[model samples]
Target: MKLYTEEWMKILEHIENNDRDYKLFSINYDSNYWFHAKVKGDEVEISNAKFHENSCSIPNPRKISIKEFSLAFPLYKQYTSGVPGIRYKMQKRKIYNSSYIIALIHEIIDDYYFRFSNILNK
Candidate 1:
């Protein structure tokens, strides 16, 4: 999967012209990561944080790089593959559950990338 390519420009242009909020969740073995973006008009703010059970520590907001975006897909796939029966869950729980987070991230990624066919295909 190639990133920072011409296809990426299409995503950037879409973000620039639209007002949307998107978040991507990923997990590597035992650690969880959250990548968030808030776009308004021509302004875009991106930030990320490491997820912990007790708290989520966010670093300073900065522009997201293609490398980060590229790594997210595999991490997301690994997370979903490791979680069993996640797709069958019905009732939403009001607590900290990995399944819930996975489901939410799946929804967000699907919706946000629906506009960019190349992204999801890659």
Candidate 2:
């Protein structure tokens, strides 16, 4: 179960239900909760991928459709972090849990999507 509910997920579901070709996002999340994916048809990418912990490593970005993008849990955590909702108490007030991180990321991506969609469709 997710730590919190997201209305954006419902919108994504609606998009998928209405279109097939628009459902091929490419984000790759590993066991550690890090992700790496590039927006299709764009040279830019967004990735906070962890190559190898305790070693010199680099992130590998992959191109995926915008429809395939998704947000997952525990947005950020240390090696031995505590429970989800409870851990928020130990951290700073600016960010609480996966909910806050997801919202922030969603807002950023949504902004970029709106900004580019107008140009791409025209």
Instruction: List lDDT for all candidates, in order.
Output: 0.42, 0.33
Report the poorest 10 consecutive residues by lDDT, candidate 2. 19-28
C-alpha root-mean-square deviation, each candidate: 11.5, 14.4
Best by lDDT: 1
- The collision pairs in model 2 are 25-68
Q: Who wins the TM-score comparison?
A: 1
TM-score of each: 0.36, 0.20
Q: Which stretches of candidate 1 lie over 4 Å from their true place?
A: 1-7, 23-44, 47-59, 83-122
- Model 2 regions lying over 4 Å from their true place: 1-44, 47-57, 70-122
lDDT of 2 by residue, 1-122 (tens): 33223433443443334321111121233233333323333222334533423321225533322222222333322212333554354244333223323433443334554446547868
> What value does the lDDT take at residue 77 in candidate 1?
49
